[model samples]
Target: MWRNTELVRGLTLSLALLLAACAGAPQRSADPQQAESPRPAATQAAPPELPKSSSESPGAEPALAETPMHADGLEPSADTAANGSSPPMDFWAGLRSELQFTRCADEDTQSRHWTKRYAGYPQRFQQTIEQIAPLMQYVAAELRAADLPVDFVFLPIVESTYFPHRSRGERPAGIWQLMPQTARGYGAPMKPQYDGRLDYAQATHAAITLLTHLRVQFNDDWKLVNMAFNAGEYRVKNALKGSKGSRLPEPRGLSPITIEHYAKLRSLGCLIDQPERFNLQLPIIDDTRALASVELPEAWPIEFLAHLLVIDPQELKKLNPGLFGTHTPGFPGYRLMVPARAKDDLIAGLAPLPTAVSARWQRVALADPEQQRTLVLQSGLEWDLFTSINRQGGERVWLPTGTGVPKPVALSEPAGETYRVRQGDTLWHIAKRYRLRVQQLVDWNGLGKRALIKPGQWLRLRAPE
Candidate 1:
């Protein structure tokens, strides 16, 4: 919920206004052939909203269109294919084996610019690779799963330097640097408790879907799809229509920044393919070290789960960056990203939590005989007295004196001893497990209707002493 603060709202409003102003503002352009000026390195803040003339707004790029997957999915070239039928042992090796667009001509100025950036500082370059090894593995796996060209794996370096939590002050956020509008358009949940864009799994899936849609829209031209991603889809479409032949014209109606983005992806792909040419060694990303997604049976507080898994909560938080608070949201069937090494521990840790069973509660009011008959008919209660009692806010009833009273009955008397609350326990969960109503748990434990339970606390399963 912290991600949805007033500050984020205010910043979002300001961004909307800024885009509106930039749309009508005149922009300067030069020949695309000349050397385009580079922004600060990928490590710095960037990809600001540039002015649009014929071009579409940067962060306001349209949501992913519902383009069907091509008849034949994009495939890796022979050179990029892994040896034999066995899976590649290394994550980076698997990606490299599937690369289809790592080549750039020797004389291409755009690609050359990034070649220098990669070669400028050998140490920093290697450090960057090491830092993003796990993230890269995840992206690579997702692309492979979707049968997308592995070349797209480098797009994040151009967008967010593979930092999941990176934000441009309410501009595109997440590893994919997805605009809020685009993220929402794709239906990647963006609740107060969770920003799906910041979640690696959610962000990667949404971006890949967009990329796939673009590939189909542009007739499988990866280059044009990359441009569409940076510039708006309509801008690229217009450029294609305006050009003389099938191929986009030089510049392709792209501004300097969009061109740079295209170059960055091509350059990064090329450099990874031939790092030896620049006297650089690419780091091996261990498949064992990558984060793995585990679908949680129920919501769990991060701190308590971390303790059970013998991991630091912050480290766990890094893997699932979207959650805004101590606990994951109560969305059913939520998936959590945890350390690959700790998957077994996580399963074991969750084994102790009570499995939920189906239960339903009916509301009824206490009233005098004649009123009760009318109430029974209206509310579907039998003639029998309710087994347990609790108050639901302001429902009409009648007292012996014929004075109007308001109360509700909770079914089933509480009957168990206190159970020590576990990490993922909720009142709804505990009540369902014991076949007791949630309201009864609240009344028995003296907990407020909205009280949140914590691990290690004692909760009364039956009526409290």
Candidate 2:
């Protein structure tokens, strides 16, 4: 049985990786603090009371390490308490009351929705939860420190299902589901060298910043803040105008919005109205006393740390999904959150990031004359990997074997060329098809919005030069 389970797990990971490879990769945001000088690794010792793995079921609703609930808080009214006993109303009421709850500890009594929604595929959900629960603890601590509602930690679960590489409509990316504009607004640089949205630490800071801003804008209303996160501030503002005193939004605008937006906001409001539906509770996670930090050397890979520490790479990856790629990108250094007592040993065990620069036989080319640099193709390297690394430095560098870069294919003098936009086509796609970048596409077509391309539009591929 154990061997079978291990086989299943391996197959699952392999499938996930295969799917990822087939899908077009999304853009990532960069860490803001990465450009600063690297910081030395933390020298503190690990905490003595690190929670034992065997104590709690892996991926079970995260066991809160510390209670943040204060007794002075207002008690729920009889009406609220009465509602809490109802199946639909109970779970959410518990959340609103800031009490802790989970799926009925009895596996049999667990609601079908809860089982299907959260626990049906125990292996997959458990794996995701185990990886994400630690980070959730970190997020919860940060929010609680600010006196904000702790349920904000659930946003990532809904957004990415704890998958750091998940992407949605357009190029909105990362666990927090940030679009490029919003990511940039939250201080994420959308450049090749860095993408802050994928940097877990930086993105968490940005998520908190955005959440705080939304909370303030909504007058500390958690429900409205959640709505804002789902549908954008403008849509939420419109919804607020429509939902006067009722707990639910009228069924009117539901059609106009995307199902994801509609479903998420409705689910959020439902949780507000009747928390028991989701078996949610505000958890106690204030165990900062037992927390310690592990700092990484610049560009250190978590996989290497995992190998050095004799821990599973997946374990380290789960703990630090924000690292992105196989290694830390563009960041000068990063801090890893761990149980407080384990800090010293972790730091002591870490090996310095390798910097052996070998001039292996590789093809080279001049990509940009302005930078006075050329792209090199290292032998035996994957073409996509090579291109991705070079693109990180900006300007087209190298193409895969059998995909030679077309040398500035110039358009003939002043002829109107009609181009039909296909499905999944964007200005960026059109630019690439014409061996140009987004800027060139916009300039050629006189388009004001870089993201506004649609299927079937006839575009003039070339302008009078």
Candidate 3:
């Protein structure tokens, strides 16, 4: 019994030693490279990082108390609050922080028209927010990406109330509310069928660029910049010459125009601060997956293209507000904002559409080419289109002379033509004149996008493929 006990004790002792050795053993590295290059303990043991809080991150929102309660008491879904994880750059919250145009102070009814009325501002705000949901995010993104204040985003609301392609029978148009000259300066094409000023994506970029320039020029004083934007920099600077350098002490000495602009912006800012406090059930405005911008070589009918892309036609129209009508003009490398969900489908469908199915061409008939006649173009219908098609003209035809049309013709063009570049001409003007696409001009001339064609420059006008 003593011998058996001794043997058992020895076996137990050996097992204990083996277990302790196993517990203390250094593990081998799974990666051979890691084994050769020993990493520091901190590096190997570091945990995956969690997302930072608002206070810790750039492009983040201020605390909830500093701003109005976002999402209007509801939890966030696809709805965007100014600077959250939502789509379009957390528009409201972001703009709220960037606001220097006004203080959310009490009634200055004498100077501000918005304050005199009922709570129409919130209602209008809600309406516009809802109206511009899918598109708003894109514009907001541009502002944020440019590092411009969210306050400038609201200027569009003041200007056009978030409606793209809105014209006030005045000079300015589009969501950013840029004037024709400003729009042209910022690369907004003034084509008859399609105005780039109405283009949400293009106009947003241009607007941000213009605003950034104004901000830089005015030494980052947004109020003065906005005032300048509304009532021209020249006028704003002229008004400031009477001031204490870029800032007015009070409403006492400012021009009426500057004051009104300041007052209107401030009024809107005040109302926007506490929309929920006023009982407005504003939606969360984020829609990150709303629209995707696709580059196009030529024009395509919005409805038809949407159908081809397997998306909602109206949704495409809303995304592409600057198309002005049924089709986007065939400009060279035109950016088409389509439904984000349909991007893959659109790209897949764009593999050289058939001649019968090509959106570029439309049927037009010659009504006895002997009489003086003309074609008042619809949207996307280029005047230079005649050179691309088989024209059987035996008589002189004057444009804008009431060219009566009620005939069916083949879509195929028998030949092409050319034109000399004249002063005060553009690809849009040339394309409009020749009824050919800007893309066609680019392809034929082998020019870059929006390349400068000097006076007396030879350009193809529907000259054969």
RMSD to true structure for each model, in Å: 19.1, 20.9, 30.4
Question: Which stretches of model 3 miss by more than 4 angstroms?
Answer: 1-125, 164-170, 242-257, 286-289, 301-304, 312-315, 325-327, 330-333, 344-465
Per-prediction backbone clash count? 1, 27, 24
What does candidate 1 score on TM? 0.56
- lDDT-wise, the better of 1 and 3 is 1
**Candidate 1, residue 193: lDDT:** 56
Q: Rank the candidates by lDDT, best first.
A: 1, 3, 2
Q: What overall lDDT goes with each candidate model?
A: 0.52, 0.40, 0.47
Question: What ranking emerges by TM-score with the best candidate at the front?
Answer: 1, 3, 2
lDDT of 3 at 445: 87
Candidate 1 lDDT tens digits, 1-465 = 001110110000000001110111121123211112222111231122121242343333311111110011011223322322333346656666677776644227866766665566555455456546666777787788888898888887766555453343334566676666666555345765577787777778778878877788887877777777766576666666643556545435556656666766777777677666786666544445566666664555565566556677756666676776656654544567776778887786556433331011223364555765675455343343221111122354311121112222222223225655654345654453343567887898888756788867887766745
* Regions of candidate 1 where Cα sits further than 4 Å from its true position: 1-89, 104-107, 165-170, 243-251, 332-334, 344-465
Stretches of model 2 off by over 4 angstroms after superposition: 1-131, 168-170, 187-195, 241-319, 322-327, 330-341, 344-465
TM-scores, all candidates, are 0.56, 0.41, 0.50
lDDT tens per residue, model 2, 315-357:
4544443433445443333455444545665565433212322
Quote the lDDT for 236 in model 1. 65
Which one wins on TM-score?
1
Query: Which has the better lDDT: candidate 1, or candidate 2?
Result: 1
Winner on TM-score (1 vs 3): 1
Score candidate 3 by lDDT. 0.47
Q: Least lDDT summed over 10 consecutive residues: which range in candidate 2?
A: 1-10
